[model samples]
Target chain A: MDVLKINGKEKEFTAGQFPATLAELLEQLGVEAATVVAEVDGDIVERENFARTRLAPGGSIELVRFVPGG
Target chain B: MASIDEKLRRAVVGVAGLGGLGSNVAAALARAGVGRLIIADFDMVEAANLNRQQYFLDQVGRPKVECTVENLRRINPAVLVEAHNERLTAANVPELFAAADVVAECFDRAQEKQMIVETVLARMSPKPIVSVSGLAGYGKSNAITTRRISPRLILIGDGQSGIDTEPILTAARVGIAASHQANAIIELLVDEIKASAP
Candidate 1:
């Protein structure tokens, strides 16, 4: 069982459903990558590097949409 | 404590986005005795902005940066104001705010706010970036609070009240967030000062 914590919620997945890369995780979650930045296990991952970055099993991921307004 | 004003006066601050948050932050910083302010805003003041923003009716049609300079100077004639009447981009944000001790992210759009926060945290690590989120609509002034998102990133606001949902931007509600941003910046500066005090 590969359970990844996204934002603050915990999502469990089987090996077949688990996302291999950070990009895949974002795509699986249907989050737009063009404007969103990812923090995987406290490390800031740039938008362009999402494809090459690997997701850690049982790691925490915070996909902040960045609370809006001024 | 007597020298706190001297310290604030010697420090430089940058304010990006001269709308409701930016304008009010600039004013509060000026009043707080901060010596220099680098303010940027590309848009012109509109009549609709008068509802919540710090701009006046006569100032409408004028560039926001220019009006901000005028308004800030009126609040504090001694405070030096640096006006940038252009949009801040990814390439330029780091450069524009490099000289500032602290940068205030007061943009309206979520993407722009994220960009500023990311750019500063990546390119200019250790330099604090103060931002506001979800400062739209009326009531719940108590809900507007400041949070230290990271060691160098301090964000202020309700984190839920956006224009898309609340859709009503009142002066009182927006001012609460703006003052929170201003106060957070002051706290950061003062904290640094206290840390170095010997």
Candidate 2:
């Protein structure tokens, strides 16, 4: 099994069947690319390069969205 | 030999907004005896801003920057405050915050917060930026925590909470986050001074 930690939660998937890139992972998670910022394994994934940024087993991802009202 | 309070008095902090977070943060810094403050905001004190923002009823219709400077002076008459009654933009950030030892990003909008953070990070380099996000509605106070995003960026407030159906901003929650931002600025200033000390 391949496991990824997202926002401090562990998510499991079938080995070799996990999303190949950050973009695919975001789509799988139902996250809109424009609304949030992504960080994979402590590296900021620029909006333009999200599709090209590869994902790996045991990787950690943090997605943050800005909140309104100060 | 300058005392700690004197050191704080000599520190100049740039507060980028005079809203709830910025107003409270600036007041906290002023009360703590921070030497100088550079505050900016183009908005005026509206009745709508009274719920969570730091302003009296009589303050409505006055420019936020002016009110903030006046209030800060009242808190600590010796504190030097420079008020800019203009909206912060990427083009003016460098000059506006040139003397700031730390910049507090307190815009209510996400895009504006991002703009100031990116601008300060790119232009200010080593100067720390303390910002707030996801602090809205009446949520648990513990949810407001500070995270050191990078060596130069520290973010306060729960990263997931925001205004939704409630459409409310409570003084309790916003105050917690504002205090967190203020404390982070103080910590960063102390650390910087300690690092540079012989």
Candidate 3:
């Protein structure tokens, strides 16, 4: 199982069983796409490629939500 | 006295997004005569943004960076506006923020925020990055707080508020967060409270 940490919460997903795309990961986690952005290992994943991308073990992922103000 | 204006004239701020927060931040900076602004954002205004955003109905479909630039220039013609219509990334972060006296992290995503914070911290620049968090759906306005994470990093927004499966966000919360960000920037520019400590 691979650990997916968002903000500070950790979740487990079977290796190679998780969605390949960022969007898929968001959907699986029940995250709002409009309010959040994905970062894999400290790099922002473009919205267009979030769905086609795959995750690797020990790789930390963060899903950040956009706040209304600074 | 003259030196203050001169310093302000030479100051450049890098704003990494142009959403509601970024747009308002940039606008406030321009109005304050910050001299130079490097605005970067890759989003376009949707019809849905008219609710509380500073865009008009006619501006829908325009790139956010473009719209913001137009607005900023109109507000202060003497201020320099360098608009970048691309997303800020690791490869470009250095170049984007190289000359900034202060960097405003107006991004909406958490991953990007952490990446940016780490990137700036790992670098040699003394420029401080002020970041925002937790302004979703909006009732916990009083929960919002500001912390100077480091001499060079400040995080604005409520420590307790978040996307709590409720309709919490409204124009009020957004304004509060943005104001905090602006004040942080102004403080960084004028006050060396931590840096100048004897």
Candidate 4:
């Protein structure tokens, strides 16, 4: 089993359940691609590359969401 | 051989939108004697913007970038201004801010804010960006504060007050948030000076 860290929280993912790509990771997390920015393992993953960027098992992720305001 | 004040005068700051936050930040930086300002905004000065933005009523209907340039000149004629009367997108943000020492994120909507932040953080790493969030209503002036999200990103505002829920933007509150952002930018510039000092 591998542990994935998202915004500092840890979640366990077996080899089969682990997301293969950043896009799948975001989808499983219920985060919309439009409203958030993703940084995986200290490197920012561009929105266009989400579907192509592979997620490293046991890696850390930082997802920032923007709320409506000035 | 330049003093900190002289360095401030020679620094170029990019303001990515000319709404309440951008307008005020530009004005403040100009008054602080920051030498060059690069401003971009696709909007015109509407009467509604007068409440919180640093634009005049008579300037309404004029492009915000044009008004900001004209007004910044009045605030400090020695300041050099580069005005862009266009919207900023991920494709253009990098080139537009390439020459800036620090970039300010002052857009109104969530998507626009996210775009600038993402573009700057991903594409313009190490340039430093000061962004605002959740300054929407009145009072609780103390709630608006600055936080360093990372070494390159500084966020200013009460983390929870949003325009979507509050729907009220006042001069005092918005100005406070804008000032917080501007001050944060100045502090970063000063920190650079400190880092390079002998």
Q: Pick the candidate with the highest lDDT.
A: 4
Candidate 3 CAPRI level:
incorrect
Q: Which candidate gets the maximum DockQ versus the true structure?
A: 4
Measured as a fraction from 0 to 1, the native contacts recovered by model 3 come to 0.19
Model 4: per-residue Cα lDDT over B1-198, one tens digit each: 667687788788999998988999999999998888999999999998999999899999999998898899889999999888898999999998898889999988878887888899888867888888778999999998898766777888886687888969998998999999989888887667333322
Write one digit per residue (lDDT tens) for candidate 3, span A1-70.
7676655577778757666667777888777665554567766565656777787656677665544433
lDDT of 2 by residue, B74-132 (tens): 88999899999998998999999988889998988776776777677656766778888
List each candidate's DockQ score.
0.55, 0.43, 0.12, 0.58
Count of residue pairs whose backbone atoms collide, per candidate: 0, 1, 13, 0
Model 3, position B166, has a per-residue lDDT of 38
For candidate 3, write residues B105-150 as lDDT tens digits: 8876666765566566556356678888866555666766777654
Candidate 1 regions exceeding 4 Å error are A5-11, B193-198
Give candidate 1's chain B TM-score.
0.95
Q: TM-scores across all candidates?
A: 0.89, 0.82, 0.69, 0.87
lDDT per residue (tens digit) for residues B53-103 in model 1? 999999999999999999988999999998999999889998899878899
Candidate 3 colliding pairs, count: 13
Local distance difference test scores for all models: 0.84, 0.82, 0.71, 0.85
> By DockQ, is 1 or 4 better?
4
Estimate how well candidate 4 is docked, as a DockQ score: 0.58
Candidate 1 collision pairs: none
Q: What lDDT is reached at residue B196 by model 2?
A: 26
